[model samples]
Target: MPLPTPPPTLLRDAALFLDFDGTLVPIADRPDAITIAPGLLPLLERLQAALAGRLTLVSGRAAADVRRWIAPLEVAVAGSHGLELGTKTAPRSAALEEGLRHLRGLQAEHAGVLLEEKPLGAALHYREAPGAEDACRAAVTRVALSTGMEVQPGKMVFEIKPADGDKGTAIQTLMQRPDHAGHRPVFIGDDLTDEHGFAVVRDLGGSGILVGEERDTAATHRLRDVAEVHRWLNDACEEMS
Candidate 1:
């Protein structure tokens, strides 16, 4: 059956988690190349307040990076695919170093690959080098097994993040906080990496709304794309008001 659209009352008692790329904004050729909508900041601020400060942006980028992109809007954010909480990242790991080295070598080999260095791990983006997908996947998966890091595959990038945490763990951790008490989790995401989050929200008696094309996803609801996402949020804000 096709997934249902979330009702207007979905945000009534929600602790909302939103994915960044391909959800809040369109995916760009380069991560830094994405441009935020002029009204997005205000809309997010309104939604955050309407939700009683239970809004968070869950992304694979560093928390600091997301903060830079949505500056002056103070909302909760989890980055590095939820491995990094807020601006504070975990200490670098030996396995992570090895993974970074491996990615650097791969970047050298595939000049078109862009290596994004993060505090917890690294990502090799092959959007500019679509032909290097197999190489990138193989390198990351190989390094992950040997070094015990996690290989996160996305639209056109392979990320080597710490194996310890994922979007599920981050949402779980956030739910445990006093502020999240009595609230149901509602995750809105648009990537394969977001599967973990969808599963967790379902387990928590909340809902998951997937963006983009339909697939065998854990999400129970669907939004067409970022524009629909904005409409949903706007409707949510209105209903919850």
Candidate 2:
């Protein structure tokens, strides 16, 4: 069955929030090559001022990585999926020291695989080493189950992160701020990691827009691909300008 298209009013009334990879930037063969368009940063900058600073890029990448991708113009940036929270009002570190301590042991166990530790969480990426996927998941799951953390699955990685910090938590935190207090929230992304963020916006009387092929969408709307996301963004920027 075809899902109904969400109205433009959803974008109009909402505070626009987005995810980076697979949402704005196309997924790359190498994750490092997911670059934002040259004009995108400047367009987003204009939108921010038009929206009265209501734009945010909520991503799983580190804050520094997000900065590198979209430099010069600083929108609200939440990196490490909701782990490293940074906004004008509050700057939060990962608060995951204990989680990291445990992850190091697991990293040693899976030394050949990529174990990335970001400020908010730790991930065992198996994209490059598909042979180790099952073992990596099992190892990460063991840690999550024993340590009282939750596991988040991304494109080709398994993450064990704190139950507390998620995209929902990040959105709720943003909504509570004085500058954005009255605005509705709209989150957009594509990936299993984006579910928490979709839920956050829905619960806050906002909406979620999913990009790409649909599963059971917590998202209220959907777009075909990253290009569509860019088109919508361009439209929004024009409207705001």
98-217 per-residue lDDT for model 1 (tens digits): 667887898999878999997777788999999999999998888778777878889998888777889999999999989897899999999999999999999999999999888999
Candidate 1, overall lDDT?
0.89
Check candidate 2 and list the clashing pairs: none
What TM-score would each prediction reach against the true structure? 0.95, 0.85
**Clash statistics: count for each candidate:** 0, 0
The RMSD of every model to the true structure, in order and in angstroms, is 1.4, 3.6
lDDT, each prediction: 0.89, 0.77
Best by TM-score: 1
